[model samples]
Target: MFLPPRWLQKDSFPEATTFLAAELSDQFLKLLQEVGPQSNEAILVPASQSLALRSQLRTELSRPDDFSPLVLEGMLMTTVAQAGRSLSRRHHGKPPAWLSRAKELLQDFAGAPPSIEEIAHSAGVHPAHLSREFRRQFGCTPGEYGRQIRIQQAKLHLTKTRWPLSQISLQSGFSDQAHFSRTFKRYTGSTPLEYRRSFTSQ
Candidate 1:
């Protein structure tokens, strides 16, 4: 991952009075405000259909990070909202604690597959919020991420053990061999038996 800039020193808070996750966009607003205090600058943006604000934000998400993928994505979106609020003083970013909660929720939820409500509670957000942004940050929804994680674990078991397919499926979180066979083929284009053979033959 790329190193963060000097501007992002997390410890430089209250004492030095830096930005909170909620205030990130606010700080940017301050920057814009300081440029002329009361004058508005013509910020040219390409996303003309939906609020140009969201388009501008999508652009800032290209930055890399030390946070896990989901956390990084939330942080990126937060940064965008901050940029938008800074430019126009719209001020609509999630609370820093909420974003942190979402990260922890992502970690906790993945430890075992979780219900949408369980995940949302862990993250301190509504189920709808969890479902919506979870997909935005990850290409798949939370449930899909869990399913893929389970499937990948199944792959590991299939390659590393001569265990029977039923046992492998059970151990790796599948409901049954039939379910495992379907998922395995979807992921790798081969049956479990064929996958085991490839690994064993090698």
Candidate 2:
């Protein structure tokens, strides 16, 4: 998708390609401000991931349910979020004990995670220090690590249980299904239903 700073239109759509477009929400625009301004660019979608999304989108379009719009929005937001994260770099080094402790705190949250300040306090450091070192050693912010863990748990639930999306979201430390769907897609490039279908279709 061409973001700001550029515009183009195809006179003839490619038979082999499927194009999906979404309007950026006000909330997502605000998030872009924090991620920093990015020039219009192309992101290559992996074949398998693209196939899964296309299949799911077709199903949702044909069957239109309460969750269809929400899932599509989550997928779009996921794309933007991943683009921002792609600009980050991971540094390799031994992690300090306190940073390890902070990571442990993030993984151990059973429900919604504690604030970064709270984790920093538990790890015996200031929030800024924790944020910096965590990214330095781990390559992602503290919140991102927490999200990874939550997404991991959600994946397990998607594969191992018959639980509905809402139940899995609640049990996997998300505030609600929408939050869970958005974060899950941000990391996995697929929504919960799409991910589950991948396992079941095989």
Give the number of the best model, judged by TM-score.
2
Q: Report every candidate's CA lDDT.
A: 0.56, 0.72
Alpha carbon deviation, residue 151, candidate 1 (Å): 1.0
lDDT of 1 by residue, 1-202 (tens): 1111223433311122223232224555465455422333333221221244344445555564564455545554444444343334322344356545665554444234668887678767898987776654433467666666677777888888778999988887777889889887765546888877776766
Question: Residue pairs in steric clash, candidate 2?
Answer: none
RMSD (Å) of each candidate, 1 decimal: 15.9, 12.0
User: Model 1: which residue pairs collide?
Assistant: 25-82, 29-86
Q: Model 1 off-target regions past 4 Å? A: 1-112
Error of 2 at 23 (Å): 32
Worst 10 residues of 1 by lDDT: 41-50
Off by over 4 Å in 2: 1-93
Q: Looking at candidate 2, what is the lDDT of residue 73?
A: 80
Candidate 2 per-residue lDDT, tens place, 1-202, comes to 3264345655332123445666677777666656644445444343334546667778778898898889888776775565445433222345788888899989887866799889999999999989887765665688877877888899999999999999999999888899889878766667899889878877
